[model samples]
Target chain A: MLESIMHWWEKKQYRIAPYLFISPFYILFAIFMVYPICFGIYLSLHEWSGIGEMAYVGLENYLNLFKDGDFYLAFSNTLWYMGASLIVNLVFSLILAVLLNSALVKCKKLFRTIYFIPIVTSVVAAAIVFTLFYDRDYGLFNLLFVAMGGKPLDWLGDTSLSKFAVIGLIAWRWVGFNMVYFLAGLQSIPKSLYEAALVDGANSLQCFLKITIPLLRPVILFVMVTTLIGSIQIFDEPYVLTGGGPADSSMSVVIYLFRTGMEYLNLGYAAAIGFVLFGMTFVLSWIQLNLMGAFERKE
Target chain B: MKRTLLLILVALMIMVVVGSSGAGAQEEVTISMWTHDNLYVEFFTRRGEEWAALHPEYKMNFKFTQIPYDQLWPKILTTLAAGTGVPDLIGIEISAFSRFMKGDIAEQALVDLTPLIGEEKEKFLRWEPYMHNGKIYGVESALCPVVFYYRKTAFDEVGVSTPMETWEEFTQAGSKLKEKDRYIAAIESSGDTPHHFLALYYQQDGAIFNSKGELMAEDDPRAIQALQFLQEGVREGILWPTSSYFDAPHFAALKEGRVVGNYMADWWSVYYQKPQLPEQAGEWRIQLLPAWEEGGRRSSTAGGTGFAITKYSKNPELVFDFLHYTYMTKENQIKRFLELQYFPTMIEAITDPQITEFSDPYYGDQKVGKVFSEAALQIPVQWQSPYWSEAIQILYKEAITPVVADKKTPEQGLKDAISKIRALMK
Candidate 1:
């Protein structure tokens, strides 16, 4: 029996060894990712309170989501955050990356490390600090504004400004993260291209517009897609900073889902919310990738 | 052959000695507990040592894990749902208790403590929040009576007296404080549940739900009145609107004397007030919350926690005995009050001299326990509903913020909150 088993193993080793070596990833992906997605779908079709029996109420949770005003508010707030952060973070990081990649810059590594510190910093700690910075009366922002002959504005108390307050925290934490990617992209672009453009009598702005942007398309596309996905799932900043408050003006989709599932124990409804979020993320990402010509065949 | 027989005799003798020793030894039992508050763990650890000293025949091994507030409930709920790896005891917050009692799972997950409580129920003050269908599942850790904490110097500076008797006088004092460029109290308009509102509403005998767990806030005039009082205070510039309670910014306002008074539970003093504002220790005082009317109830309950035995516990009776000895007994109840400064729920402990005569230099030698115990007896029952978490979220968004921010009238806001909460119930 031992000789036969050894002979069979030797015969199949080439074909089976690779799969045997790579089985861990597939096993984990199926257990953690695929199982949860399938279970979430199953859970979305019922009414459950986490511990009790799940009662089937097909399509009701979905139908209710359409009419849920709080869901719409949370959806719109999440979009506002995504749109604002994408614009602010992308522009700011791009500028920093361009500056840092320049030959005239001093201590480039030091500046890069300093900028990247926020990314590695604990978000909860950063949020606590930012909360103090956004305080209505005693915050640094308000104090500076008042010193500059302006009135102290309620940065977090007013519903109109609470979203911006949370967005400010998001931008602070993420701009550096995106900048590192842009910096790599900027460095990867050959200096010879810019030299050629300057030799052709193009001004600096023209060279930047003509050579730099076109070469950075792939990086830009990558950053935009990742940023959009991250923004859609934003929870920590708003949760720790504003708590989705001032009348839910800063509420993100994930925060609402968390409150529903964890706080309210409406697990089935929360699952429905989760599916809706997944759908939104999928459709938006696809649109983004398509618009960027990611799937287009090159000639 | 003789040597082999001698070795066998020696092994038999050793076996007999070991068996006799094992028979004389005490059985060991391990009990695992999970709590959100480290203070509870500290309190119980000391009590557990005392318990071990008294009961020597059984060796008690306790395993206590203190989890953060946000993570603990989800962990406990998931464990309960999976029907495995449950702790022997769980400390449940008052607001989260409804989640545990949502379905028949409560019956399956928690041991019915009613039989354990038995005749001692009459001695306890607040049990409504932990009850479902006439069964008690948790023993409350504190009475949590909401009291008005004020800066005595601020009031004296404004020529307003301490311990105003009615809401009318409280508002009158607010105007006087406003004249001095100070606010009477800081009311939270964002990032908090309607705890202050609920305290006042409960003071006027208002409830979000009746005994049947039906929606009653819309029709309850007291709810509207309570909200209107807060709105009027803010509009008149008597009350400052803070984002959250017991946070840094709120404490800053207190320190700067921008805000002077706070209506919060007794636990706030020990956890927040004294620790945060240590410099202003002797300048503060505690009083029964001013009545809405001259003769209304002076106190209402806001926040609480309770400990319950899980059905998964191997020794439910032993756990109950431990709880009864530590929490339900008069001596330990007063001891808890003296140590934690949480007002006792036991009627006997509330009046105990150890509690009633206790004074604190932080409040200028005020008998803090006496004031709290007085409020403890008058604490109105707060009904529980499965929709409680959702209802409070709606109440804050639809009613508390809009009404206090002057975006909507009290009645309109209450109407909106009611409709939203009702829709949730459906």
Candidate 2:
């Protein structure tokens, strides 16, 4: 009887094994992600302070989110940062990769390692170091500017200028990481394409534009999308360096959501803010892809 | 083979029962206390070993867990919401203390600390902050009364005496002192204007909330005047602006003779000046914060923390036992002040003859304890509502920060903060 039961169990296991293997991920996702998102959506229609009774508030939270000037300010800041970083990152990382890949540049491995160092460094540490650099008085940047006959500028303290300072910090950390991808894309392209261009009397610039740019388009698009996604969730650099201050000039959308949810404990309103950001991200990503012709066939 | 498997299993089961029953005799009741204060953790961990030795019969174990100051509130909120994983005791920041006191203490997921205060509860200074109705929910172990920290060397060079008797004298001194490239003080930029604003607002008996927990800051002449004073200081170039009070630039300014005064708590006397500005060791002195007018209220609290026991605690009595030994006992409170530099909250500890008599070399041989003790008594009792955290942020973001940055006039900033806070209450 035992032998029969064991044999029967093994046969049943063969039928159900694949589902059982995949169930853990789906179960965890349902619990952690799906449940929270749904609950958050439910919470968006109520007012709760965690310890107090949650009072139902209907669509008021979303209405208030639309009216909040701070929300619009933070949203604009995040978009500006995302756009500026995409252009600077893609252009600069491509330049760095091309220069490092050139024949005249020796010790490429050592140079690449040095460039990649900031990618692995902690964001908080880099933000702190950059804060020292950007100090209005007695900082390296200001002193250097003064030495070169320019008046010292308040880099992180001025509302108009703080967004750019945050952008510069993001560039310092992510430029090398983007270059590594471009380097891989450059390496994978057959040398024959470049050689053929050279044989056709094309100069280095001509070869770069014709062979590199057109072929590296896919990698550039990937870099742009990933950078945009990362930008949508940016928090630490400004949080550490400027604290989103000098008058909330560097406050990103996600940081505003965080302050609402964690600091203020307006979970319902914070949930509405989060979903609005989610909608914005989805539409923005969609528009970005269409503009970049990501879905177009290879030419 | 099957019989052998059964016999091995039976033997393992018998071993498990005996071992489990034997281990029950030595099981220790570990009480976890969470705090954001790192110095307190190191002190408590050492003291806990002593506490455990004295209570060997109970088989007690004490554990101290430190959380970051900002994250502690959310951690408590989540654990309480989930109804599990709450530590036995938590150090509640004074800013966050009011939010945890829902109707009754039990409904609020806090153990009523009424029994802990016992018969002599009147002696706990600033104890009003952690109590509700007739019951107390927590007790502070430190008095964080603000005092004026000034540079004696800078004042002497400018031909001024110690402790400008009033703000008018302080400002007059600043104009004269600037010839030597010195400012009277550094009003921390828009970023930290609220803290200084609070100290000044308290000088004139301004309260953020009335006794019945209503928003009351609109058109308060004291608050507006206090904000205007700070803005005027910045505009006159008497108050240098740093990103915040304790940032790198601020420290550099404090270390050198760039700025002279800091209106901060007594703890900063040791924590900030002793280590950060050691060169100004004997050149520094403590004076009561200069009054808004002659003989006005002299001192107020900026920030501090207190201890609260969680309702989820399996042994609330035992947790309070440990807290009482550490905080309520007169000898331990005095010991904490004498050794660890944590200023006392207990009235007896604050006025301990030993504490007042000990001379601090850092402050030019000033009896630091005696000076601060008198200042602590002058701290006016002000009621705080749960909306205080929200109100303070609005004051910073809408009023003080914008005013300092010149984005808004001082009057306009104050009006905006009032309107915004009014909207929040709705």
Candidate 3:
């Protein structure tokens, strides 16, 4: 083994081969990621309101963040949105994947494609479609609701209901995508384990509980981590739908950061918000991992 | 590897040689101008060629960016912050011109065109927002005054005679019009724009900022009265559902005889009374905004924009001359008024035979030019300081939008707005 390793190291291309393979990622990362992040942190220390001399505010922006009531409202809204969406999406996708995995499901490819259509559709186009869907007066949704003896719900306008409307949209677009992942994990489960459980006179549901779920632990962890990260960075849907109002009821943390940096032209304050958002995301994700681990071990 | 490196080096050397070779050559000075309207691109492109013909030695380099008014302020501010490659000429709105004027942002970043164009201060009327410390910074380009456009058929159907002057009569007529299965007015909602509240407040003797530049909307009785009028209008079912006025259906609704009147600025006449609505062409009439206190004080803001030379411009002289020729010149002003239906800012354009001679087929050959010109002169000028945008946004968002949404009472909303704005001012 030592002689073979020496032979491998003696190969002519060994010195440059690894670096040549990784150079693309390194170059792109340096240009796009590393430089911007360093510059953004530097920008956070100064008071630059899009004009004139840059006053050295140091930690003033972070201090101001403590008092900004709007930031708190936005923070709570983001948490509520993420919490609600995660619960809804996970349950719905898992149920969907299980149902699709069953033998009764016909033309599975066609059904999958139909379900996946919304995921691939342009966000702006979907937003416009949802705008019509949420329209109070002449909307098809209200028409159906009114026919069923229900009052016409102002889905997009009402501050309380607006988040649900946006979440419904998020779930609509992402459920199929997440379902595919779950389905792959389900397929990857060892068939003999389920068969052996069945040999012990266990039912299909029992076998799934006893073996399938335990096998799908790694997949669930991957999905949970990814979805959590994606949901926390939610910007476009809330931005296009509500514009952070009817009194900021739907203002996500990212939307607030955008308004600070772009609209209010306070880049330093925006950067401070960015760091706070990063901390929140990291802490919440760690908690999610711990909870998921507890659930995994129980199974 | 050496050959490849040599090739890359040779290319770089050639590019540098080509770039520096033109340094000692006759320099071409390009003036960058940013405009919000897409129509400006067409207007400037044509004018640029003409200007270029007049001065062959200096190329008239034009840079146009279409930024809508809502997003213009933030984009301008952010671009300015980048501290590189800003448009030398930016089309500043009358509403937002003060924001730049307040801080040394414009003062430091823009050229003092006073020395070059200061001799002709009297040539323009009312220069508060565009000038700082008695120095001319911007040029007046367009006039935007609020005008009342009512459906003639709706008026005749309601048996209301031409031109109701008093607020009570206006309200009564609006109520009467609503009674005939017609909406009283298709006014823009306060939630979207609270500046209408300020306009209505001013019409009712309310002032936004007090003598010491303190925001006084909350305790100001006039603001309360104005909000009451809006609330009353909503209560009386005179106002239609909140919808986009610019949408073609809104115009079609007017033509199909749904809505009676719309309180809109003169700029709207271009889109509203057009060949597309030839059937309703002869049935529309323009009138002055209804007096808030029964003809007690028929005064509001003199609305329009003035052009300014940015301090960052390498060619201030060229930009000032462009403004003078295109906007300030009586001949070009009349030409624009005739072509684009813009109410010219020049005082002489008001009385010029060119304006009086024009007839718009859209308004059934009504002398639109003469009407707008008269209204432009009578418009009351207001204090436009640098803090106006921040103040207005605060007032609109905190006070006006909340009241309109019924989140808070008009009094409570205005009070909140005042308190919030006071904090920002400090």
Q: In terms of DockQ, which candidate is strongest?
A: 1
Q: lDDT tens digits, residues B1-426, model 2?
A: 999999999999999999977776656787887898877787777767777777765677777889997688888889888988889888887777766643232347888888767786877787767766656777785778888888888888889887777888888888877888887887656462366888888778887777667777778888888888888888888878667566677777776678888888766766677778777788888888878888787787777777888888998887788888888888888878877677777788778898888678888898888878878878776666656666777788888877876678778888898898888777
Q: List the lowest-lDDT window of 10 residues for candidate 3 chain A.
A: A290-299
Model 2 — TM-score against the truth? 0.91
Model 3 lDDT per residue over B1-426, tens place: 999999999999999988867553535778777777665566566666777777766645677677776677776776676767777787777766765654457677677767876666666555655766666667756666566777777888879886767667778887888878788676444233454566677555566754345565667778887766666676687765442344443555666677777665565666455644667777788777777655465434434566667766777778777766777778877877776776776788777878866777766677767666666676654555556655665665566555655667788877887887777666
TM-scores across all candidates?
0.96, 0.91, 0.84
In order of lDDT, best first, we have: 1, 2, 3
Q: Compute the lDDT of residue B45 as modeled in candidate 3.
A: 66
Clash counts for the predictions, in order: 0, 0, 11
Residue range A1-299, candidate 3, lDDT tens digits: 99887788778567878898999999999999999888778778877756777778889888889898778988889988888778776788888898898889998888788878888899878976786677555457898999999999867656677788789788888888888888999988877887788889999888778787788777777777777877888887877766665557778999889877765556788998998888888988888888877445553
What is the lDDT of every predicted structure here? 0.90, 0.81, 0.71
Candidate number with the higher lDDT (1 or 2): 1
Candidate 2: give the clashing pairs. Answer: none
Candidate 2 chain B, run of 10 with poorest lDDT: B98-107
Off by more than 4 A, model 3: A1-28, A190-220, A294-299, B1-27, B67-79, B94-103, B131-136, B187-192, B204-207, B210-213, B241-258, B271-280, B297-307, B382-390
True contacts kept of each: 0.81, 0.38, 0.23
